[model samples]
Target: MITKPQFKSNDYKNGLYLVATPIGNLKDISFRSLEVLAKSDYILCEDTRVSKNLLEKYQIKSKLISNHKFNEKKNTLQIIEYLKSGKLISLISDAGTPSISDPGLVLVNECIRNNLNIFSIPGPSAVTTAVAASGFSDKFLFYGFLPEKKNQIEDEIKKLSNFNHCLVFFSSSKKLNKLIPAFKKFFTGRKIVFCRELSKLYEEYIRKNIDELELFNNELKGELTIVISEKKEEKASQKLSESDINLIKRMINKLTTKEITDLICTNKNIPKKVVYNFCLKLKNEI
Candidate 1:
């Protein structure tokens, strides 16, 4: 059995502590997380009631302050003053790591610029957990959240489809119906994994072809992180013939095959191996 970290007495010395909390499962909370919350002079959280539940569960009695997106600007200054006065402050979100798809980046950046010490007690992160279990490439782009508008989402997906890296983004179950259709339109023929309720008892990873993701989206629940595989480039670009390759080579004969590969690999469109193979096949035939 794994032992949780004990909330150390002196961990929150000064400055800000960004604590990672469990998304759903209380057991997901880390040892240092409990420690930071216990020792901090004040806790700045997204939702007081939500944070209260976690704190009360652990029996932590620190003061709680609301610091969400709408009021973060004002609260940040207040937090800075507290830090300046040598008070220990902790920033936590309702679930998962702070400032990810949630809120916290602005304050964290401000704290860093002002030379305040910032410590992160890492624990459960939906982004990392989803990516780790995705079975996709290790390399990925964490998009955090998708655009709210349909056209904007299509444009973004089209732009990202050019890359070979797996892309991850957070979405809500309410938006899953619309989002899955847009994904199918812009990113067809790619593999996608929809991770829901990560680390919870009902945690699930539904892997499907982008074309088929719609059916699975019907019964989806809880918060979601969608991981879409980069579009298949060679299949998209395979129409280019030996003649096209020759034309490109002739246009830039002075460039090396590696250089040519780099140029054609624009946006991770084609697999490097495919590009290199095309260069070799064309070079020998020419």
Candidate 2:
């Protein structure tokens, strides 16, 4: 039997409301989010111009205040003052939930410092949206955006490669294309999903094995939410044989640890860590 939800009247409170807006399609907004925005004394927007389109669509007339990354800290005092004065101010990003790779944290922290009331009016989120559609393990980690520097990005990806659960990331099309090589190198054997223009008319989900992924010849438009599938289980590598230990004992005095590791791992299915640790155990025994 299907049961309908019993809707209740919202008792709008006076405080800062961290509202989640639609990631793409403006129609994806919730009734509760709309009601809160409609009754808000003011709306704090990451970009008033971008937010205006959504607000106007729903006929919400609340005064808009610019509250992006550059000006959030400066606007903190005044916003806190408004909250203290019992004003119902709502903070929203241009899209998605505020503070999820978006502005709103500064003002939220200010509200907390002043012991002011704060509420979250949840709605659309690109992270969960992409992960849910990925068909990967539900256990996941959301790494908001990758770093810009090549070395930093490489280091980050290398570290993230160790996790066994699904991983999500946000990136512009250009950045994502540039990252294809790095993704291929570190995330080998994993499945990947590229979610572009989510919920919009041109929405797309490009799924591929990491090894099979290739850079697009033509540039793709809009932001991308990427989901990498969880690591696949592999058969445990066999323990070193008596001959293997004797071979390492012979080379232990002649080759460096790294050289030994590289040489031994060249043809073996064993992990470098296992070989490296074994090499170290032989060294310490000397």
**Highest lDDT: which candidate?**
2
Q: Model 2, range 170-258, lDDT digits (tens) per residue?
A: 99988887788899999999999999999999889999999999998988887899999999978658687677778898999999999
- Per-prediction tally of clashes: 2, 0
Q: What are the TM-scores, per candidate, against the unseen true structure? A: 0.78, 0.81
**Per-residue C-alpha lDDT of model 1 across residues 164-241, encoded as one tens digit per residue:** 789999888887776777787878789998898787778888889887665452556777988887655555554455
Clashing pairs in 1: 5-31, 7-35
* Model 1 TM-score, all chains together: 0.78
How far is 158's C-alpha from truth in model 1 (Å)?
1.0
Task: Supply candidate 1's per-residue lDDT for 184.
Answer: 79
Assess each prediction's global lDDT (C-alpha) against the native: 0.81, 0.89
